[model samples]
Target: MDRYVSVKDIEQAALSLLPKGARDYYKSGATDEQTLAENKLAFQRLRIRPKCLVGVERCDLRTRALGSEVSMPVGISPTAMQRMAHPEGELANARAAQEAGTIFTLSTIATSSIEEVAKAAPTATKWFQLYIYNDREVTRNLVRRAEIAGFKAIALTVDTPLFGIRRADVRNKFTLPPHLRLANFDGHLSTKIQSTDGGSGLNKYVENLFDKSLTWDEVKWLKSITSLPIIAKGVLRGDDAVKAIEAGCSAILVSNHGARQLDGVPASIEALPEIVEAVKGYNVEVYLDGGVLTGTDVFKAIALGAKMVFVGRPALWGLTVGGQAGVKRMLDIFRTELEYTLQIAGTPTIADITRDMVRHESAYSKL
Candidate 1:
């Protein structure tokens, strides 16, 4: 733990701690994983052009999202079955997010129930991540329960009409452990995800239950059901970003579902600038997730116009290492690195981070 100074270090530690099946599920991406690898590489392809001689004073990392102030612009993205990483699961994650003063987005498929997580971290600024099920009533019920639990917003993931073909899961025949269940749907849905002899049980569960017909009209219908702001996640194309705003989404998250949904999509960061351009003056906040691993990555995303950045695998790595404490440490590293980056870049605050501060390395290649 003392030796884990970077997110990558924490990832290696977590991989060592998690079971083979659980680890594969958490780490593997779709088909060939080209998008997954590119998501991280995309960040490196951009070069930061810093300003100098600005009065170096105190740096402020505070930013607002969905009408609430968070200590930093980094938030935890929703991931399912966290107990596979640590016993405390989403409970640890929620507490850490609250303590860090950032948002914690809970998955619709989390091991901890909405009521249970709310009970565990009553004051955490929570956002519920929705996966629209085949039954409209089930989806409605989940949204209502999240509202009742005091979640601040709804991040509706739109990319996964069906689960991606993650070969590792298929090969491993991955299934939720018998001890765990999708706690959110205890009686209302099938909590148990049974293993198939040949393929991933989770994939079968999603195919059987998730509604493939979801479209822009469904987004509008969701808005009618919840007073909380809706954030459309997994949008990569500029056109799709516009449609989300037209459908009354309060924000758009430029993501490729962490490259777990599509193997060939552009990296989320690469998609951010275009989406930001598309939604210009639309009163909609833009955010990004997928392969964000460092403060530099967070800073770069904001420079390109993301209001905030979300991390999924990093938080799970933290939880796997030391539960809540480990998760907090992971966030602390981000904060510390971000503050250093701000100082060196001569950007004193979040607003000071500007588009000119970064250029895609390709722009320099022709020079």
Candidate 2:
């Protein structure tokens, strides 16, 4: 473990540490995993065309997102049941983000309570990830609670009205560990639907709570609940990007749910430039999160019009290995690799990164 090779190796190590069912649930992405493969392939398709001899020495990777400054243009994407990998769960993640001077997002389905995590990293940039439940009062209460706890933003996940076609989840009939609970819902969730077992127990909650009747007007409802800026997650189409912006979203995160919620959708990286173009002007910011595995991957996404990038599964992998320390180690590896990559590519600073560095196979970087 001391001599690190690649993020894939770290992932494989994490896989070895978990039970078969847990591994399947975390590692497999949607039906046939086509988009899962494409998320990584899209990055490969991007070729960096470097500019040389510019007297490059100092490299600046810091940037801003949602009016909050970031030490680097990256944040942790919301992932459920972090405790399944490590007992400390979201707290470890929050501390890691605090140490890195970036944002940490807590999933609606997270095992740790929002207040608990807020206490864990009191000064870090915190965002509460939301998935509207069938229960309106529940959603409103959670929003109010997040605001009361001083979370800076609210990110509504939109792409997964239905769970992805992941065969492994079905094969395993997964259930949340007995000690864990969806801490955000606490006493708010319906007990009648709590008896089911399959997918993440969180998914059963999803089936019960997700509003089938939710519409564009709902975004305004969320705004009225609390004054925190709303950042919509899961926009892959230009039309959807425009819709999110018009609905008064502060930022549009171009994600395919890390290619875990859909099998055929374009990679988030592939969809970024179009969304960035479609949502032009009007103070809208864009971010990307699917299939990013390295520091070079982060640099590439920013060059392709992503205001910031989110690292999803790799963060989980690092947590599985050594809690906060492993998370720190993994991010350090990516940062070092990216710094080396930027220097070698002759683009020393993040601003030096541009679309010319990437060559698209089609109009898209990778489908």
Candidate 3:
């Protein structure tokens, strides 16, 4: 724990330990990786205006999200495969989420299934990420399984239209190692579907599975099948956030799929203010999931009107480093930094984080 002081420190250590293909796939985002780089750079564009002599004391990081009291406004984002990084995979992630008293999302492309993860970490707050497939029953079955397994919500990711323009996976010819398997569909699909022509392994998988015709109508169909609240992920604009509410979604995760789905679009943080302005009066809660790496980043998002912020690559990096313990350490470190930031930033309670704490960089025309 003393050795890994920064997120980059843990990431570098994990990359050194994992196999070449696995490391590259886990670290690399879409083509040219401009968006991934922009995700971090977006945070740099914000400046925190800490109040002086505010008498901040006894900081409380706890907040309510989706009608549940989470220890913090941070949740684990869904990534494709985790076992590739560590044998424990999503289970380790689940354990960390449970220990932190936060929500953890399981990807549809996860190496571990919902039931398996639920069994592994029963007390963890679970949310399943759904990528609508061509097979309607497959989609229904997944939702049904999650509902039965006690997952609190369904985070339906709608941004990826047949995966991203990830050139790294194409050249690397990335495929799951022999040891790793998609536990949910292993026995169901005899041969794996690979879309190598336009993209590669991932593109092939996206084509074979991702149902392109999916629309807001499907959200209703899904709602009819389960009692869980639907969270629309991958939103970057205010209109879409409003539509999600109109579609009966209880929450909307403001993201660009960790800047993995689209290139040259605005970063998650940059898009936050607009969406917050659009849905300020709506009962819907707003959440974010990109470029979040520090406790201050969480505080900044809260100031910018985000109810909670999700961490994507960092948690996976933890899983890559030392499985469950590594993930827990990552969360713990962030918690420590966040408490430290809140005290120094003069915020004594989560409610004290106001819009004035954030100063948009663009307001200053240095140019």
Candidate 4:
């Protein structure tokens, strides 16, 4: 465990250990992946302002997210196909989140079924990520299953109308390993990923199965079917955030599908301020997830008004490196870093982290 002290270390080990098909599929982003690189690069451009001589002692990292008390502002974002990284898969990821006292979001296309994960981490604060399917019954059934399984909220993914053009997946002809299935769906739907002449099999599966003609009305329709709070994921613009709030989303996740769905969008952190400002006084929580690699990255997002931040690849990297223990270690790294950040930066509590604590690097050039 000491050998892998950082998330990047785990990521390197994970990438090296995974098979070519799954490796490329997990790492690659849309088209040229410009946004992928920018997500982290954007964070680097922000500078944190530290304060001193405040008699700082103990720093608290606990906060409330989605009406639940989390150990910290960090949570695990939904990333598909965990079994590709390890044999335990989503089960390991969920258990780690439970141990860390944070939330774990299960993807609609997870390798583990809703019931299986619920039983695995019955006490974990779990949320289910949903993708509206072309088949309305499939969508309803998924929501029902998640509700019955004790998932706390529905993170409705609104970004992926169609899968992005990830060149690596196409080149690798990405398909799930024979042993794994998209466990939530039935027989053929679960096993749809296969090498196709058209390119990435997963892309084809989404195109054929996902609903593309969705509009804001879909949110209302979803609300009608289930009582779980909806979180509008993949929002980048302020207008969309307002619309999400207006259409009854209790929270907004500012993301660009981890830069996998689109290439030219802003980093999730870069897009956080607008959404945060837009949703002010709306009784909505705004979270960001993209290139959150370190505790400073988490601090910057919170200072900029993000209610919480999530990590997708980093958690997967942990899972790949050591399954549940690896994920727990990865989270502990963030927790420790965040605690140190609070104490050193002179913001001893989550509320002390304000907009003034962070400044864009470009802002200093004006002086």
Task: Give the C-alpha miss distance for residue 341 in model 3, angstroms.
Answer: 1.2
TM-score of each: 0.98, 0.94, 0.96, 0.99
Model 1 CA lDDT for position 55: 85
lDDT of 4 at 354: 94
Q: Score candidate 2 by lDDT.
A: 0.82
After superposition, the stretches of candidate 4 with alpha carbons farther than 4 Å from their true spots are: none
| Model 1 clashing residue pairs (backbone) | none
* Clashing residue pairs for model 2: 133-209, 134-209
Span of 10 residues, lowest total lDDT, candidate 3 = 188-197
Tens digits of per-residue lDDT, candidate 2, 1-367, equal 4555677777878888977866787788988999999999999887666677865687777789989998888788999878888999899988998888888999988889899999999999999999887778888888998988889999999887867767887777676766667787656452322345555544565675688777778888888778999988999988887887788789999998877887898988989988988887768889999888888788889888998998878888888888887777777777777788788778877888887876665646346
Q: What's the true lDDT of residue 15 in model 1?
A: 94
The model with the greater lDDT, 1 or 2, is 1
Off by over 4 Å in 3: 186-199, 364-367
Q: How well does candidate 2 match the true structure in TM-score terms?
A: 0.94
- By TM-score rank, best first, the candidates go 4, 1, 3, 2
Tens digit per residue, CA lDDT, model 1, 194-245: 4565799888788778999889999999989999999999998899999999
Question: What TM-score would candidate 3 get against the native?
Answer: 0.96
State the lDDT at 166 in candidate 4.
97
